[model samples]
Target: MAIKVLVVDDEAAAIDVLKYYIDMTPTLSLLATFTDSRQAIQYCMLHDVDLLLCDIEMPLMNGLEVAEKQLGKTAVIFTTAHTNYAVKAFELNIVDYLVKPISYERFLQAISKYKEQFPTSVDDHFFVKTGTKGHLERINIADIIHVEGARNYVTIYHGTTQTITLLNLKDLEQRLPARDFLRIQKSSIVAIKHISGTKGGSVLLTNGNLVVIGPTYKEQVAKVINSKLIN
Candidate 1:
């Protein structure tokens, strides 16, 4: 599935360059471009946008305003000439924030986050081999409940079923990518898509699986929740 992207920047040159990089990536497709940040927010409300590339300072509205309005449907990556917005951008938990004048290399790095967020599933079901007869697994990315570490082994929980793989939790974490999967504890990483909400000591996944939150990972989890990725 091609990623539908919206570009919002006040500068014509910056928009052109950013669009160029987006076009270069075969997985991404440009949905629209807006010089006015206010119009960008309207576009977001009307359209199904997968990713957003927006500038911080604009005429009618700022990038953060645009991001706050659009964050529910689209993953944002801020493009700005100023360095001051970086901390705020991180606080927003944007996929990737780039300082202008942006290079194609840097642009590519940022867009890679989009790919990670919306990976193309091979089939409705796939296989993860662990050298013992190589079992066929019928897995959909959206159906994933929760993942937990049992010592050196990682357990994949989906629906009412569970599968244990020889891979460690960290190794599984690397494979899943941080853009969609967030580490809630050293032993657990919950899929952002699967998260319903957080309450008390529990992280509630959409599939109704409740995972415990670790004290060490509370700050990072707070950042994720406060950023409004999940309700």
Candidate 2:
């Protein structure tokens, strides 16, 4: 089932842009859109909205109040032009914050957070923003060989393809199943199933790759590897 989405923004142009983005995403179903914050709150009374993409500043009522009304019931992602509201928005424990005008790539990143909140199936896969704007690529957990991070990006190597996503390595590690993936270093994580063996201080992957174990993570990695050893 597609994630039921509701869009609320005072500006018609902003609503239209969100509508276009919602249409392009394969897994999202736009339930309705509202220009008035009050009307949006009313619409939620009669419908089941999985995700709410709402603006912070509105005419009659601001988006923060709108979120307060739907708290606990609907997962929210704030779309606003202001940078000051970030601290307060996260206090509500919403999915993500999108600073407008939000690009399609950034929209995808927000959707990725929504997906994390409500997983489709057994948490088997997740979407990542690809090189192209307005495009998202789904990556399966079981297919991943190893992931390495540099700067603000992480490269996911799976099957024969490598996809670079704008995400911190630590953030990505949190999403991956702990049992399925091993954090061998600060900069890289190897799929436990794809790990062939450890060669000296390095972890060897099935596809002929060696990831040097970070000193900070060595003890934890050693403990995991030692547990699997057949004495």
Best by lDDT: 2
* Cα lDDT tens digits for candidate 1, 1-231: 456789999889999997877644445678899998888888878888888999999877899888877666679999999999888877877898888888765886887776777666533334555446856555565566688898888788877777877776654554453456667776887878788888898899876888888996687678678888544
The number of residue pairs in model 1 that clash at the backbone is 0
What lDDT does the true structure give each of the candidates? 0.76, 0.86
Cα-based lDDT at residue 206, candidate 2: 84
Q: 136-188 in candidate 2: lDDT tens per residue?
A: 99999889999999989999999888899998775676567655777777688
Superposition TM-score, candidate 1 onto the true structure: 0.52
Residue runs of model 2 more than 4 Å from their true location after superposition: 122-231
| Alpha-carbon deviation at 18 in model 2, angstroms | 0.5
Q: Compute the lDDT for candidate 2.
A: 0.86
RMSD of each candidate relative to the true structure:
13.3, 12.6
